[model samples]
Target chain A: MKTTQHKIPTARPSGQRPSGAVVKPVGARPVIGGASSDRVIEFRGVTKLYDGGDIGLDHATFGVEQGEFVFLVGHTGSGKSTIMRLLIKEVQASSGVVNVAGHDLAEIKRKKVPYYRRNIGVVWQDFKLLPNRTVYNNVAYALLVTGHSRKQIREKVPDILRLTGLSTKLHNYPDQLSGGEQQRVSIARAFVNHPPLLLCDEPTGNLDPETSIGIMQLLYRINKTGTTVVVATHDHAMVDKMRRRVIELSAGRIIRDEAAGLYSRDESTREFAVRMRGARLGQPEDS
Target chain B: MRFTFFFREALRSLKRNAMPSFAAMVTVLVTILVLGVFIPIVQATTGAADEIRGKLLIDVYLRTDAKPADVARVRTLLADKTPNVKSVQFVSKEAAYAREKARFPDQYELLGKTNPLPDTFRVTPINPDKISEIRNSLLPVAGGGTVAVDPAIEEVKNRRDQTAKILEATNFIKITMALLASLLALASVLLIANTIRLSLFARRREIEVMKLVGATDSFIRWPFIIEAIIVGGLGALMAISLLAVGKVAILDPFAETFALIAAPETLNFGLLIAILLAAAIGVSAAGSTLSLRRFLRV
Candidate 1:
């Protein structure tokens, strides 16, 4: 386990500490062995079957720790996208427990879904930017949803735009921007509210290799700033470059789990290669 | 902030779809104008009928045996005692006989043997509405000298009451027309709202994306609702103006034909206020209800 150097402070006052108090420094990672206690997402025996009885995910069990950048790599029909959907409560799990940001996916009220989404950011391959709205408004939308005042929005929007390298295109509409620029605007929009979790569903899928690499670098930078990042893709090259923790799925099952894996290998090593390549490069070699 | 955004968006959308908005406005205007013209005429006729009812009068006849001094005393008593009596004229037996002979010339030859008519006091009430009460009050004063009211005057009052009733029925028809007009206006609003909804549905993907990014449902609906309101308001305004012009151009000339009976000046500020209020309420209610139900889906 790679330990974060920061020390965690006591959760309660020392004078009022009960007999069971576990003393720790301020900012220390809340980890037991290699697993962190502050998991942002959890899936316990989760299953999702489509309307026609086709299985989307079959008894998936996993956990994503807070502020941890995790890659979810799988082939087509392997349930990577299903996991992402379930995490955001876009689709309910068929059975078992699925929790994200302290809300149970199965029991969360429909009206509260928007509030739930406020704690998470979603970036898409298509950018999903309104062609009529400028880049600034697109990013400002996230903050607006969280009921941020106009003054706060005005102050925060410019800073996020600058951070996402979209300051120059603040006045530009989606139609006027290139694919890469649109993705940047999307990223800015996703992160403007400073959500604790950021889910990118093939964020670099539509871009060329250079653009894909740039977007991957941007995601890498975002992940380092303590925002939990989950990228669902079959992208191999970008994944290998980042060399992050990888969870590979096959036939709706987590077939391989590797730490610091590479992009390519022989038939037996295909799992690690695919997972690593997808994580770092954001595109599988075959895809 | 939401309303501001909605207003801006609605205004922008209206500008963008100028032709359709103009069409909607015109539809609203025409409907409201029709109502404006139809309502006032009905109201004026009702007013005139009421005026006639309040100004009706009756006459009373005295017995032939009654002396001239008795007739004079009766007249003075009626003038002083009756609250409603404006004045009383003593028609002499000779004058009554002359009037009867003039009314029926063939009967005058039979009456030549003896004057069969009695003297009478033609009593006019200050207010026609008080005629019934005045007649009821004067009945007990008929002593040995018989007091008789004119049958012709009673017939005229009955005719006026019937006319007033008919005029009031016309008011009912006018109200029915207003109701029908309002219903039609509501239908128009629904149609316009459906049109806006269709436009919004065309951009469903954009809306979904907006939702995914945390835009509230109200934020999504504001622009469409605002657009409907603007369209409805403009339509109502146009209808009012057209109605005013039509009243001036068409109603004024039509009223001149019945200048003796219909007081054109009766369509005053109160009436105008009533018409404007009805239109404003009708348009606003239709627009808001349709937009909220059809477009907002709330």
Candidate 2:
């Protein structure tokens, strides 16, 4: 196997970790019709009405600027997945505009939607790796879709694999790997394109808290490279500890948009605070 | 490079989804096999029926006083105007009398100088099923005995008792073969189409992964199309090979031993195989591409 000379991304200290800086009010109306929208993702009065008149998202609006790490924290059926689906163009907005990476989702033709999606990478809780493909091929598949040269894939795949800490398991198929390793491969595939935006739908939902942190750290490192990351997860403790922007949804509505948000204000208990304190002490969070 | 990648991916999936792939292959094989074996049989049987049909001769007797102009008009109507009449042979009363005299001199001599055989027009139709059509056109529209509506034709005579049985039998054979061949083909196509659909459902997650990873729709679709082609092609080839062996080893011997009345032209084996291959592959590819629409709705 060929080795990548590209340096592997290292772990970040707690203090230096990236977080969302700008705080916006809940349900803020997105400014429309700018020549160059710095917002990597913008949802303006977005609503997703599914078949039989069921609403997936109800006039929800939010924006994430370039290079922001935001967590989408919501319960099951709270319409968090709908936002990710809209951003990725998996589902269309029923009555609003969705702009991702400055391309309006509604404007993309069906034939050109694939090219439009190339700018955004998506991950799901299931890790969604090709079951029969090796980790290397799974990651390389992203670049392959864009018609990259063999040399480019050979170089880029290993670098992303190394960054995701899967260099040793390049040839391992998804089912052969642990849940965390599979999730890492999934992330590697999603990040290999170095897309401007990455959307994760409960990416670490199946992994233990420890493995979930490892996956999150890998995402963090990618986010540090200036890729805007949107993680839709219900991992409240992990979101609380990271202190990134949390966009919480309830009943198809934006209930909270907090800068340096906890998973929930109610989750900011004394026990959780002690855990954070211990996490800050010599017992490292990176491990 | 893209082609090679798609082919490799197809091959890998073929191995991974061995059961569904096998079922698809088997379905194609059975469809082609049924078609291959039955088509030539139908063709051969129909050819024989056509041969028997070619011999149906309709004899139309003309009035003894028919004018030359009337005879010419009747010939023109039967020869140029009719749809099914292949050829019209004119035999005058003297010519008909001479033919009968050559066969039996005493009976004709008993007739003495009087010749009872009228000037006849012998009509050969294109097909046996067409005999009734040709006969119908010659009959009087007023509907009586089998006399022509034309003034020249005294009576239109066919050996209805003997010819009716042959025409009915041949017609039944042709109709049954045609119906059976079409039904088999339709059944085969539906079977493979369903098989491809089921396989797609099984591998839907694979499609989901490919789409989310920024793969274009065409990029995601190529491997599946290639896979279907392989399955369809392999199945058709297998069935064809079996048919070829059966033709050489079994059918050839039986065809020779029977000493059939006429050597009939059946469907060309090469053309049949080509058609089967094309149909199998086309259906497989079409099925996969169409079924893919539901899952690709991103």
> Candidate 2, residues A13-124: lDDT per residue as tens digits?
0122133343333233333444135777777678899999887998776778888888988899889999988887778889877777777789988788778878888888
lDDT of 2 by residue, B47-145 (tens): 888888888899988898888888889899999987788889999889989999999998988889998878889999876666778878888456455
Candidate 1's residue-wise lDDT over B9-85, tens digit each?
67866775677667666665655565566556555655665555544456566666777576766776678976788
**What are the C-alpha RMSDs, in order, of all predicted structures?**
10.4, 7.9
Best by DockQ: 2
Provide per-model DockQ scores: 0.34, 0.55
B150 Cα displacement, candidate 1 (Å): 24
Worst 10 residues of 2 chain A by lDDT: A4-13
**Which residue runs of candidate 1 sit more than 4 Å off their true CA positions?**
A1-36, A50-54, A75-78, A240-242, A249-287, B1-183, B222-224, B258-298
Compute the lDDT of residue A282 as modeled in candidate 2.
44
Please tell me the TM-score of chain A for candidate 2: 0.83
TM-score of chain B of each: 0.51, 0.81
